[model samples]
Structure formats: structure tokens, C-alpha cells
Target: MGKSTRNVKNSFITLSPSFFTHLLSVSPFSTPNKNPSPNLSLLFFLSLSILCTFSGICLLTFYPISRNSIPCSALSPSSPLSPFLLASLSSVLKDYSPNTRNYDEPDLSSSAMVPLPARGVAANPNISAEGRDFWKQPDDEGYRPCLDFSLGYRKASSRISKEKRKFLVVVVSGGLNQQRNQIIDAVVIARILEAALVVPVLQVNRIWGDESEFSDIFDLEHFKKTLQADVRIVSSLPSTHLVSKQSIENQIPYHVSPMWIRARFLHQLNEEGVLILKGLDSRLSKNLPLDLQKLRCKVAFHALRFASPIQDIGNRIAQRMWIEGPYIAVHLRLEKDVWVRTGCLTGLGDDYDRIIANERDSNPDFLTDKLNIAKSARRLAGLCPLTALEVARVLKGLGAPSNSRIYIAGGEPFGGKQAMQALMDEFPNIETKETLAREGELTPYMKRCSVLAAIDYIVSLSSDVFVPSHGGNMGRAMQGHRAYVGHRKYVKPNKRMMLPLLEDESVSEEEFRSGIKKLHKYSKGQPVLRNNKLDRDVLAYPVPECMCKR
Candidate 1:
């Protein structure tokens, strides 16, 4: 065994130089030297071929090195090799060591290969309890919210001729954040069509059966006032235009350009004088022009203010949380509907799996994931919602104290209070809207899901730290809102990296904790510009666009 190990080490040493040479030969610097000597060139090529042959033999003899067997010094930064070469070498080695691979190591060839942490683990684990103060304000990253719509507004207003200023009506449906997104898109669409927008009609929620109107949930007057300069807003369609109204039958395609919108609807709008769009959820493109994106930010952060009653109750809950000291808001998306829709097993064993399976069978349309991925594979892929136990473990691993105040925000979890037992045990100082508010305080909005979600939204926005067990509209909205207002610390759980570590029976507690910390070091709610090329939602990562450096 010792002799074999020695041979492997020697082989690796011998192969190293050939690998480095190969890299150099292919690099940009490998441009042919001028005035080359024929004899010297022949000799160089001959020697390079021999070295490559030797390297191939070495690789064949001992390619897969065991993590435990390899000496750390071989891969250390102190080596003579440049950092880029070292990184490349490490990546090559990593591709073979699947069993003991470090997921934290980024791929040198492609930055896109780096795993983004799922939405829950904190950025740093070393900060004290008072670290809450660190999140109250934006990071010192020289950027602030600056929605400059002056140019776009001028251009849009100029295009809106008296004959072309048609009326646009949108019927927005879904939960609070979904509707909020539609509302934002509705404004942008109105600008695209250069039409006066009628107050958005809120489709009665099928699940909650709540008949709350847009005016009931959001301050309509404020919405109109905030966009008065950008788009024309009206309470209702004009009597003459109502008869000429045309409802769009086909659902709009996702991520359409402004030109596509104009091409599709301009003629209809001109002919009919009014056009109605329904289920306008995520139909508009996320990668709109700067003005449109800024308008989205403006609508989301500024225009879409909650109604006074909802705001008052939400503020009361948030204040109550603050009184108990800084609290963390966790958007735990472990509801039954979530499980049914995601087709992800609850990790609560066979009985719970059967429950989810039965629900999925009863309503096949509920399952959003079309691909039939195994439950275990889905969990490993970070598709499953983190259970209460998993959330508790993540929080503890991130150094949140047992006494840390946590506010659970979401619909009732799948298993209800029983499902939350683990988290409650881990952190006793946990509260929900049901717990924080006085009896009958939330009674009015108890059945109103959107209003209740608005309450959760407010509390979440006020939190010193925000964590989402699953990614959704609310989480995405909160992420963008927090980044826009101030870079409040948001802990996106490194689920893809973390779940495997957590599941590995061989991993010790210390190893798991360290792994979790390392996975999320850069996953905090730091200021990052939205990459439009990647087609990431601007609302979730607004920087340098809606924001400007002072």
C-alpha cells in the first residue's frame, strides 16, 4: 500500500509540468514566436510529444487520487504555479473526485457553474446577536435607489397622441405578491401601449374565495398619484369606450419585447379603443429597458402601498416583534399546496409521502413540475422545501442563538403545529401573525389571504434578517425590496450544497456546520447588479439600474 501511494505521488508530480505546459500552449499567450528556428522547433515539438506521452502514462497509472491520500501541500497556494493555473488544476482534479468533492470550489472555466445558495442561510456565522444592527441599513456598497424615468416618461408621453391614447384594462389574479407583480407589469404594459389604465380588477381568489378588490388591498389613489407623470390612470373605462372594449383571448407569451407588445396590441387598441388582459402574471418580460425596469421598481417599492388597515395591522405586528428585540422572518413555504404543486416529498417519511402523492393524484393539474423527478433526486437538487427540522438545523448552523426571535411567515404548514415542533424546540422565541397580534386584531383579515400575506410582507420587510425556505414571488419581492431600500441581511439557504452535507450520515456536526458556513459566505443580501443576460428578475436583484452610487 505504501509503495503504491509513493508511485501515485511520483506520477502526479511528473504529470504536473506537462499539464502546466498544455495550459500555456493553449492560452492566448501561445501566439507563435517570430523568427523561429526549424531545428529548434523540431526539437521542441519532439520533446513536448515525449513529455505528453509520459504524462499520459502517469495519468493512466494513477488518475483518481483519494482525498485522504493526497497531501494538502500539493494543492496549496504557496506553490510556484500562478493562481489561475492552480485553480484550473484543482478544477480538473475535482471533476474526478465526485464522492469527496468540495462543492464550494467554483469552476475556473465557467463562473456560471458556481452554485447559488438557496434562499435561507445567513451570510456570516461569526457575528454576535447584536449583528441585527448590521442589517438595519444598506451595506457600504456606494449604491442607492434612483429610479430615473425622466427620459422614458418623455418618450412615452410624446408617443401618446390623442387618437392613440387608448384604454387598457387588466384583470390580475393570484396571491398578494403575484398580483403585485401583475400590477407592476400592468403599469409597464400601459406605457407600452400608451393607453390609460383602468384600476386593475382583482379576480376573486379560488382557494380563499376572498372577493377583495385592488382598492381594498392597495391604496388606489396612491397608485394613481405615484404614476401620474408616467402613465394615465383612470378608475374605470369611459362609457363610450366600454362598448368598444375587446378582451384578449390568448395568454401573452413570457418575456416579450416592447415591440412585440406594440405589434400585437396597437392595431387592436386603435380599432377597439379599449383592450382587456386577464391573468397577466409574468406575461411581460423581466428584461425590459432601463425606464421600464425602473418603473417596475417604482411600482413595486413605491406605488403599491398596502391599504391603511392592512398597513396598520402589519406595522403593529412588526412593532411587536421589534419590542422583543431584533427578529428574523422566515418564509417557510411548507404548506400542503406547496408540496402538491412542487411534487416534492415532505421528508416526513412514507405516511407524509402518501399524503402528498394522494393530493397530486387527486389534482394532477396542481403539480407544476412536468418532469418526473424522483423525490430523493428532487431533494438533492434542492427542489424540495426545507422542512421545519431542516430550517431549524440551518438556523442553528448559521449561529442564530436559541433565544433568537423568529417570525414564521406563510400559510399554515402542511402538518400544522406538529410540523413546527422541531423549530419551536430549537428556538422557543418564535411567533407568527397568529401569535403576535392580540385576539381579534387579525380577525377582520383572517380569511383574506392577500391581506394576510401583505401583513407577512410588511413584517418580513421590517425583519433584521430574512430567510426563505423556498423561492417564490414573495421571497423574490422581498429580496428586491430589501436590496432597494437597504441591503438588509437575507440568508438564502445553500440548499444544493447543504442538503447533501446534511444527508450524509458520515458527516460530523462540526463538518456540517463548517460546510454550511462556507456555502453561504457570499450568499448574503449584498448589493449585486441584476444580470439581464441571465434573465434573472430585476425585482429580485436591483442594483446599479434602479439604484445609483452617491
Candidate 2:
């Protein structure tokens, strides 16, 4: 699924010389003189040199770059064939001569085939002159799910009853993870209020910059089937539930995730039979009771499922993992956006201010109180995922076999190639959704992070061992999901201990391995989890207690 540089280099080797041969053959210098005429040859050489000066300009007219193309060095101003004194072009008479180069498809390939400036975007096309143009992502063996699953949803066909006024909680929120946690709260809230729960309106998250519907990313049918017994959900507010526009003008404004929202208040404080709720952000964990936490397991692990195409892709990847002996599905949380949201600046020099400033401007709806949280506190609270280096060390310390096939699931990391250098060296068998699925297959996901994350979630859930670099939304969700799916082992790094160990000069490779094993022994397959603190310490899959045997 990726273009190899070897092919491009071989193509260039075949063409660079022939083009030069054609150039010299059409010139006066192509003829051999019986008697060497210094003056004549000098005059001919000077004229040819003058023509070569503007060769790059003329070439651009023939090979116009639509997106962008790396410039060919043959026509460059500094090229030896261009009559310029190029120190790097030492073999001017042989390699860089007009008589030596002959690249085919000159009409299509730019002079450099990269580094060429585009119409709008600034570029130094030569930047890729020495390296491959694109990253190679490979496909994995196809496999089906362990069990048949259907991502289905049923349409709501009823309006609120006029005779009865049940509490209909309207949760206006955005973001996938935040909304998910709030849904857990909403379910419990609906139960407490003895109200008919309206199907959550999964509005497009401004922060996520996506236009997907709840149904587009998830199997609402599965969600409904799982939670139908505990709470009722509808697609929209019933026709009878709406109030006149005049009534809305005087309604109380939604307080967001109102920490004080109680079931008793549902009936006691309804304004004209409709309550408007907004800012239902879910950073706090105390709103839901123990029973609600158990319900969260049902909602998050069992009720939620990915849309069909994504699940299929994940299943195929999971099957590869199953066949390939074992694999580590790592949640590589190195996206620039998440770093900006956390305002962490350990190694991200000048990018720190820019990222934070961009987030503040783009996401103005953020909880203002969360802005001042310290970086250490964020890490402690599992808000920050490990940096590429930290994750590498932790995995290495955990004695992960270097030959293990690691599936990297998440967004494009921040440091790019520079960041992945060490981690990739340690484990070369890393794979991603892009490498495992074809473009047409991925078309259904539409390049959305949430959709891709669903694929990551499924793959990680079924992996031989799941490793989360951070305790972020995906990590927490997968850890819990893997739990419900029969206690698959999950590797939770003891970051507090591991970081210090990584810094110590006395610690050997063998010692690091021992520590990692010791740290994670109780972290996986435990029976008591759905406690949110599972992010911070050793508590695990709540399946045994929460889910009864089928």
C-alpha cells in the first residue's frame, strides 16, 4: 500500500543519463572535430552554459505540479550540467552532464519529483531528494470476529405522552469520550428520574472537527439492545415534549454538566414541562453510584459497537494477531492536538505555546477551571499519554519480544519520523489501520479519527496483549472492553516508577524487565474495576462481578 523509494531510484537511474544524452546530441558539442578548435569549442560551451542557466524555469512549464513534486536536481541552478560551479556536483563530466541524464515521463515527473514549490503551499522539494517520498503502511491477514455482530439501530416511533409528564433529560454535549461518560450519567439519571431517556444527540464535536452522527460511528442497535432493560432511549425529543418558541425565550439556561443535578430535582424544577440541559461535560466521576458504574460496563464494553466496515477491518486485523502467534496493540497517543490540549511541553520546544494557543482559540467551550491544571497533575490523573520515548522504554522494560508484531492504533504522532526512530528500531513489526486496510475499504471511515479509533479499539480489545501508552479515553475504554471480553491481559506501565528507572544509569536491561513484570502482575485480569481510579492504579475488568455468566 506504500510506494518504495527503490523503485523511484531505479527509474531515475534509467532516465537521468538518457535525457543528458539527448540534450548533448542536439547541441553543437555532439560533433567531433578533426582538429580541436579551442575558440569554437569555447564559444559553443558558453552559449550552451547560458541556455542551461534557465533550464529549471523552462522544465517547470512542461512539468507543472498540481499538488507538489520534488524538483529534479538535473535542472537545478546549482547542478553541474547547468554550467554553475557546484561543489557537490564533482562528477559534472560523467553523472551531471547533459550527455548522461535521460529520465522518462519528464512530462509527468517534475525535475526533482519532490521539493518543488506548489501554487499555494510553500515547499523545499529537495527536502525529500535523498529519502523516500511516502511512509509504507502494509495490510494484514483477513480474519472474522470470534462471534457474529450486527451494528444495528431501530428508529424511535413515539412522542412523549401528553397525559404523563415524565422527566426527559436533554443532554447537549459534544466529543466522543465525554459524551460517552455523560451517557452513563444520563442512563442513571433517567432511572432515578423515572423518566423516558431521549436517545442522545451525538452532535458534531467542535474540538474533533467531525460531522459524523452517532449511528455513523457506532452500532446504536447494539447499544439499545444492551441498555434497553435499564433505560429507554429515543432518536429525538418527542413532538409533545417541545415547548413553544415563546416559552424557550424565558427558559433557564443549561448549566452544562451540572454537578448538583439530582433525580429529585427533575420533577421539582421543570420550567413549563421542558428542562434544557447543556455543558454536560464529564470530567468528574462521582455523579454516578456503584450500580451506575456497573451499568457503565454494559454501556461501554457490551452496548457500544463500531459500524460494520470498521468492525470488519478490526476483526481482520485481530485475526492476523491470532494467527501470527501474539501481538501488542499499542494506543500511540502522540497527536499534536492532544498535547496542545494538555499544555505539556517536556520535549516539544517552540510548539508548546502555539499548540496551547491554538487549542484555547479553537475550543473556547473548554471548562475554564481545567486550564490551570499542572502537567504533573495531568499525567498523574492519566490525562497525558506517554511520549514516544517513554512508551518505548516501558515496552522494552516489560521484556516485550523485539520480534513481536505491534499494532500502532491512533492518529499521526507529533514528532513524525524523528519521534518514532527508537521505538521502531526496538520493534520493527508495528502495524496500523492504514497499512492493514485498502483505501477503498477505509473509504467508509472517511478518514475520521473516531472511526479509525473504533478499528483501533477492536484490534486492541482482541490483541494477545493490549498496551495503552496513556490512560486517555481509548486506553481506558479498551482496558475495560478487553476485561469484559474474558480477561485478556493488558499492560499498564507504572509510569511513576518506570520514569525514574529509565533515568537511572545503574539500571540494566534485565533489571528493567523484572521491574515491569512485577509492576504489571496484578494490573491485568483483576475482578474489580469499573472504578475510575483504574486509570491510576492496579484494578481491572469489572466483568466477573458486573456481568453474569451467559
Candidate 3:
């Protein structure tokens, strides 16, 4: 240690030679014990107080300060700022570590627990179809365009009129031409929704539908006078066709609002107060309402009193009307390319010359090689199956036996003709289109065949499987049929994705067999089963073919 300094404990604190000299020079008890010079005594005492205060502060800063212990910085030896800073810092540290005061250990019992809601069945399909559509087609995607309704209402709300109300049904006729059967269904749904106040406005291509037939259903003359309580059908200039939006609006009548029409027409209506009845743009089967109660309610509330099902119109023809029997309603779509390239009945890559040559060269017994080619070749195979001739031949050969009648519904007239001839040739007892068309239209045929009921079995080629088409109404209709049938084995192919063209190339027979196995397993032993919870949730009560049941 230095002569004038020493280590006390672990700290080296020094009393320098100069510090002692200065202390001695200004000592109050030295000499006559007179008070030293005022300046010198003040400086000496201040310096001594500071040295002691600093040493205390160093100790306090490094260690925790208790409430009772006043930090040296807070209570400065000769000033007030030190005490203030110390007090502020002490409060800051205390507040920062408030948990330090927590004496008891944390209760671990409640830490791992998660609260769950006490609610009925976690999934319910009985909710509104509007909500379902919204969930399926999110807002981020323009599937359901975010309509700006701020000018009208801040928050969109569903409104149900207590008394009677007026509803506008906009029929959007775009994309592929809707099957006549499908159109009628859409119309019926619209009438069901509005009851007596539903007005139908058909917006189709300039040259799409038959105006006379449309007018007969809508009846514009009677509607003008208000004598007709049924839906008023009108054909306005399409908004999409016109370049100007305002121009399109100007063309529409005052009675019909294009906004309401478009909303209902595009299936984009969100059930904001007014209910919109979307017409047949796409297949209703494929995009069926997940919430069926909402669908039924919407239909019941909006449809007109005298609205007719499209099937009725088709069935009205003077055909042998079999209500429920054994039959097959075959639908063969006259695919555009199939007709243009193949010359209607002839197969693809064959023309009139090729047909005539084939007919002449083929065996006398099989003189109709051209006819056979026509029936066999297809534009969109799997989508619409082969002609009735081919289907009947295959079915008969497979041993469908006697009483089976194949009613060809849509497609080329020649295809239907060929099928009728084949059925007549194979099973003379079999009923022809003339015989069945004499009975009724598509629906009656469908009903008779037990296709839509609990049938013993549904055996067909690759095309006719569950949900008809991929993400199409065909699939949905199949589900509906299965549900209606109670519980049945839907004997369909397993992995064979039944596509339109390239049927042989796209899916293998093995895959089709696998799918059939899976479908059979699901169906169990019943002729039908109601498995689609989405459909059952909403369509539990008033089932289709209700009349046939009672």
C-alpha cells in the first residue's frame, strides 16, 4: 500500500498527500479553533460530503435497494438533484419488476386448459346458402365481387317481408345453352321463392331461345294489364353486349332494375334484404346449395303461384306416359364438332363418300356399316355416351333381358333413330321413342326407369357415373338420385375419371372397375342411400317426386 493510502476490505480508497494538506489548511479545530475562511470551509465540507455520498451511491447502484434504505444519490450530501434522480430510478426499477412481489407460485392447474363452446353439432349445412357460397367463394377472389353498397346500406342485412313482397328473377342465358330441362327447373325455383309476386326477365343472347315459347310462359300482353298475377317475362337488350353501361341501363324498362337482375342472374346476390333468384347460367347440380333450407325457403318465397316445371312442358307431349317403371332416359348431346366433321350420323374422320363406300363393301347382313359407324363414333364421348343403338346393343348383350325400355332424350335425331331401330331389332318387345315419346317427356321416362328411385341396379358404360360430370350437374344429380333411392349401391367406376372426349385413352377399364367397387361399398346393400349431409340438411322434408311417394 502507498504511504498515504490503504485497501479497506476489497476497495482501494486513498487519502492523497494534497487532500490531507488542504484539509489541514482549512481545519476549523486547528490553531485558535476559529472557523476557517468561509469559501475554503464550504469547499472542504462539500468535497468531504461528496466523497462519502459517491462511495454510498456506488454500493447502492450495484445492489438492490430496500424501501427503508435511501440511496446516497437521492439524498445528496449538499444538494437536491441526486435524491430526485435516485427516487425516479428506484420507482422505475420497482415498476419494471412488479412480479418480484409475487410470493406464491403460479397455479399450474388452469394453465393447460382450453375453453370450448357448448354448441350443437360442430358442422351444420342448414345455414343460408348465401353464407355457404360466400365461404366457398371467398371475397379475396372476385368469385363474389365485393359490391359497393355503402351508398345504400353500411351493413347488409337479410330482410323478410311480413306481408307480400315483389321479387325480380333475372335469367342469365350465357355460356353454354342450358338444357331445356334445367331451364324449367330454374323457373320453378324462381316461382317458389316469390310466390305470387315473382317477375321473370330473360337476358339471353340475341339469337338464343324461342321467343314464342318464352312469351307463352311469361305472357307479356296479360302482364301489361296486371290481369296476369303470374311472373312477367321480358327480353331486354343484354348489358354485357353493349359497350356502354349506361346505354344498357337505358334500354331496360323502368319496372325491371338491371342491378337486381344482374345480382340474381350471376348468382352473386348476397341475400341483402331482397332475395334474388339466379337463373340457369351453369348447372345447378354442380353448384347446388350447400344450405338447402335456404334454397327451399328462397324458392318458396319467390316463385310464382302458377309456375310450371320445365319437365312438365317436356312431358306434356303425347308420349306413353309411364309414371314409374323400368326404362333408361338416354341423353346424347349433339356435340358441334361431332356433327360438322362427321356429317351428323357418321363417325369422325368419315364423310358421305367414306360412308357410302363402307356400306357397299360391308357384308350384306351388316349393310349399315355407315350406320354402325355413326352410332359408335362420338365427338364428346363419356360426356354424353354413345347413341342409343350402341347403348341398347351393349345392354342387351350384357343380358338386360326383356321388359327394359331405353328412352333416348336429347342429342342428334339420327342417333335416336339408330337406337330405336336397334332396340326394335334386338328386342321386338322393347318400346321405341315413338312409343315412349307417345308416353311422356324426359321426367316421366326418368321416373319410370327407377333411375331416380331405389333401383335394383344401375349398370352403364364408363360415362354414366356419380355426379354425371366432374364438378358438373351430372355428379350432383347422381347424388340426388342416390339420396332419393334411400340406400343403394352406386355401382360406378373407382379411379376412372369419366371425361368427355378420349374416353378410351383418358381412363382405363381397371380404374373404372375400382371406382365401381368403392361406390358399391358405400351403397352397402340398399338400393339407395341418403349420404350427402349438405343436401339432407336442407332438403330433409319436401323431397322431389313427393307426389309419386303418396
Among the numbered candidates, top TM-score falls to 1
Candidate number that wins on TM-score, 1 or 3: 1
RMSD of each: 21.5, 27.6, 28.4
In order, candidate lDDTs are: 0.73, 0.52, 0.31
Model 3 TM-score, 2 decimals: 0.35
Error of 3 at 44 (Å): 99
Give candidate 3's whole-model lDDT. 0.31
Displacement of residue 88 (Cα, Å) in model 2 is 64
Q: Which run of 10 residues does model 3 get worst, by summed lDDT?
A: 137-146
**In model 3, which regions exceed 4 Å deviation?**
1-159, 162-169, 174-198, 203-209, 212-280, 283-325, 334-349, 352-384, 393-399, 411-433, 436-482, 485-550
Measured against the true structure, the TM-scores of the candidates, in listed sequence, are 0.74, 0.61, 0.35
Model 2 lDDT per residue over 1-550, tens place = 2343222122123333444555565556578657655566565676577457546445643342311111123222333233122211122112233322223212111111011010111143432321111111111111101111111111111122111455455544544565666666566555545456666666566656776667877777666644554565666666777756522111332332233455325645354455444455543344244344444544554455666666677777666665654567788777766666665653555665466667657775552336767766665554566877777777766556566678888778876766666788888887887777766777766546567767676677656567777666566666655544334556776776566566677988788767766776666544443345433311134532343321
Question: lDDT by residue for model 1 over 181-285, one digit each (tens)?
Answer: 988998898888888888999999876788999988998877776566567788887778767435564478877889999999989888878888887777888
